[model samples]
Target: MNKDFNSIVKVWEAAVRKSAGPKKRANRIFSTPMSVAHVDDDVYQVEKILNNGDFYTGQWLNNFPNGHGKYLWTDGCMYVGEWQKGNITGKGRFSWPSGATYEGDFKNGFMDGKGTYIGSNGDTYKGFWVMDMKNGQGTQSYPNGDFYDGDWKKGLQNGHGRYQWKNGNHYIGQFRNGLFNGNGTLMWQNGNRYDGCWEDGFPKGNGTFRWCDGSFYVGVWSKDSKEQSGTYYPSSGSDDDPLEWDPMDLFSVDLIDCYVCGCEKVSIFPSQKNLNMFGLEEDNNNKHLLSKKVTER
Candidate 1:
């Protein structure tokens, strides 16, 4: 009978211990709330007060903003957007007190992917960016009404593009290092146009220049000057007939006073009218109009 009573006591003690253990655990859990600090009186939201005095208010994971949040720097700079592990990693807008701002994709707090940046001086850029520099295809607009749209590399104009100036001048062609370096066309405000090869922003090779007066020149150029051989086409209905003359050609001449311009270098083939008036006749092929020792009063 005593052995049976000791066995009963052991069963009762086991039951009591089981009941008390769960009750103590329940009390402890209820008394001590979750360790996560609420952001603004809401237990669901979390905030991280940075050591550098920068304030962040948003969802938090392990004391760092992990979800969408806004961070305000101590120097009046602010960024409001998605964050991953305390780094700006997604779409966000960062602004400065100096009126400079950037709004676009961010990778590790650096401007990456498509974005737009507006400078403090009213300059603006919109397009692909890499490491905060203009790269790939993009468009830049200056405050003075100048605009550029084309390929860029390392912040310099490269590849094909179009640049328009505020003075109604424009260029469309291949570019390298921010200068016209290949075939392109330039139009001026005065109705003049140049279409041809370019180097260092000037016509350098074979090309055509059309003037506002309807005259045109087609030939080769060197350092922006017509060189060697070129053809000049005058305007329609012009009284001046087609003349083939080489400016570099040498001619034989005697010292005589020109009745016209009084210049030492006189035109070789004066018109037939001038020849008749001067009483000069062609000796052979009529190539030389001025006779030997002939003077005009």
Candidate 2:
């Protein structure tokens, strides 16, 4: 068995030597060296040879995958699209050995364009890709039927988006690092709902929280705690007196002591007269008093 294996290896080496000249052999065996444009303008011909991974031939300006054309790694990863010098340029598609595929624009071999990525695990993402990850506006669907549609950054849920769970729970709002943050609305399967600001996946700031039992609170909140400010009226409260009132009337004042001496001598004043009964001098003050007779009854 060892002899047969050695024989096969020898034949393989001989075939490679015959197909590639000195420079080409040096390029494939020692290091990557070739440019597709230098060899031929036919992209299909270049792809055919490169796809085999036996011998790679291209414009050897700077050696390796630096040039305009298709490039395929021996590990079953392949790139088909534009190339500059040796790095991937313009639009392209990369298919990995693991069955993952990315089709979009490329910058130096990194995915950086509007494209779609289908993962080996059955997850799929369609949108803008940056540096080989999901970024910017996009949509992601999981194998379990969960999905998110919105803005993404570095593979995490960020900015405005909508998340739908398999069990019918849904959230529409802002997100940071896959957690609910900023302003948003959550609707549960049991009729409970929350519409307000969120922090680290918890309710915070000013907003309304509604329960399944028809109870609700509309007020300022701090990490889910209600603050001193806010209006929290029971659902069954009467709407006729919507204005809140306090039992203690702060504006009420007590009357001063009477100036009259006798019980029967009740002091009366004209409505139109502006005389200061208490502070007036002589005639004006005594006129009303003198008209009344002192009586015990």
List, residue by residue over 36-129, the lDDT tens digit for candidate 2: 2224442212212322344332333332343444444444444566656545667767665556777777775567879877777767889997
Candidate 1, residue 88: Cα displacement in angstroms equals 1.2
TM-score of each: 0.63, 0.57
TM-score of candidate 1 relative to the true fold = 0.63
**Residue lDDT tens for model 1, 49-87:** 333333445555443456687664444456778777656
lDDT for 214 in candidate 2 is 67
Instruction: After the best TM-score superposition of candidate 2, give how far the Cα of residue 227 lies from its true spot, in angstroms.
Output: 6.9
Model 2 lDDT, residue 290, Cα: 15
Q: List the residue pairs that clash in candidate 1.
A: none
